[model samples]
Target: MVHEYQKDDESSVNSADEALFEMLGILPSLAIGNGVPDEEDDENSMNDKGGAQALSLDRFVQRKDDNWIRKVLANSDNINLRRQYETTSVCVFPEALRIPAIEMRRLADELVWGGHIYPSDKTYETLRISKDGSIEERRALTRIENFVNYHSGWNALCNDYLRRLVSLALGQPMVLYKEKLNLKPPGGSGFAPHLDTPSLRVALGDRGPREFCTVMVAIDNMTTRNGCLRIAKGVWSEDHHVNTVQPKAEGNPDADGRAGAVLPELVDQLQFEDLVCVGGTIVAFNGWAPHRSKTNLSSFARRAVFLTYTLAAEGDFHDAYYQEMEHLRNKWRDKVGLPTQISNDELMELNALSTVPRT
Candidate 1:
């Protein structure tokens, strides 16, 4: 049911403008061309700071004016975007955001350190124990969810620009359903082969939208050694609808696979492509894409922000989706004789007990 991004009619244009102005009124600081400098200017400014600029949320806000929208629309090749999505169910844009190197480092530090410094009910961070020959429980962070709600810079990048990019690819307006910051520190564990649609369905139930897309913006260089994402090649065909049914809960001992992951037998039959990317690269894929990553054997950390969206017409479910997921997570914790309340220290203990080291 997706189509090209045709110019809206006069009434539609008026409505969109009204919505934009209303949003601007509520978030005056986010107004287009507000004191924030352009990406090029920001890159130049980093030179004065010895290429080690302090992290500031203002640097992340790109100009979201009508002119910016027009430029984005003009640059996008809708035909090719559609063709790739239809054929492979995935698309990649290398260095699309063009964030400065200092900015990237600053952002990563903010995400990693903020969770430890200020632990709150709003923060959702998960830790993991290293599997590499060390008997000590190496507390490495694995993921942080709903960060956009706190960091204005992330909100601008994820909720505005990235969301618009996916909307262009899908040829329809989309809204944010959820966001997560995934961190794969050295010797971190990888996810088992699975489709996001099934997990999303389990969380949202019948209220979920029929179509969904996830956009990943790489904050660090992703490589084979660093556990880059690997996706099945063209597994989402009309003849086989992988989005409707949930995979079996049987775990894979060798791969350290989790419940609701695709069986190893089926995964072995499909061809997969490793999505190696440099910092600022963006990868978008449909909900049904079977994807996973490997352990981070490399010395560095692999960080990326994953933003999931559904059609705007379906309605915004950002808060509600997180609520349901938290409930399910709490239930699982209770069953394991763990506390429902999560804190910085509790996260470490939880992962220590729950995470199975990958062989």
Candidate 2:
């Protein structure tokens, strides 16, 4: 259940305060694990891909028991939010995660120091996965297309809690596909406007190209000043891409079909709303939604986790998708060589992320 951001809610207030303090690197909490932590990090570690521990559907059916769970799901996936998403392609559930601060901090620490924490400098950093799956870190930091490959992070994503939450929100049983965390440190630049469906379509299993959605979990309070995602409203269903740049027309395509950023003019014309919300909020949106973030001017880190899913009937492609990504990353690394990192411009060309942290 999400902690309501209402007045007099001490827990929610404290959580926000703690999140802010943590982002500034001023607060300290118990360090979690010795970096990657082990399988012992979780008892439900079997959440690989969608191979979560098998539970009988009988538990979810009859819909008689667990009224609270049902009610929470009902509220989280209420008609209003669903309608908003359907209409605008974006909606938010503010302060959704009710996990205690101690636990949240522990998880955040594990992810921070776990496998690889890349600096924003892509010039020198590269993550390579050798043919044999051995991981190598060169220069740079992590983002949506390139991010943590650690298993514990995957476990955190496929946990039953999120699965159930996302399932209810999407009104269907979903299989976890790809997960990534965007740790936008203070002063980090935002990404250029782009669509996610083109890449996420591969995880659709049997579903169509548009049969995917992403659930973004806020690890810290997201504010415009700190580089929260700015998304174009009510533009998900349109095939709006053009060979143009900023400063031309309203509602023009931002980019041509291939991997490219939305045109600068389109970005200006589109009505983009900053998704400002407290920590733990879950912002769900369609895969085709055009979204980007801004540079973080505030002295705080904006960390968020994105979990992508398709209907369960299609199949589970989480692990397989990541494995392929690893191979490709390593292959790219080998081709690029070490010491010399890919430039931000090249990264933009490759990932179509319009905004990047100025290094």
Q: How close is candidate 2 to the true structure, as a TM-score?
A: 0.61
TM-score of 1: 0.70
Off by over 4 Å in 1: 1-61, 64-79, 94-97, 116-136, 235-239, 242-260, 332-337, 343-359
Best candidate, TM-score: 1
Clash number by candidate, in order: 0, 18
What's the TM-score of each model vs. the native? 0.70, 0.61
Residue 302 Cα positional deviation in candidate 2, in Å, after optimal superposition: 1.3
Candidate 1: minimum summed lDDT over ten consecutive residues — where? 1-10
> Model 2 Cα displacement at 245 (Å)?
10
- Write one digit per residue (lDDT tens) for candidate 1, span 19-125: 55456664211221121222222332344245564334354444444356546545665536656877888977433234553455566567666766533233222
lDDT (Cα atoms) of all candidates against the true structure: 0.58, 0.50
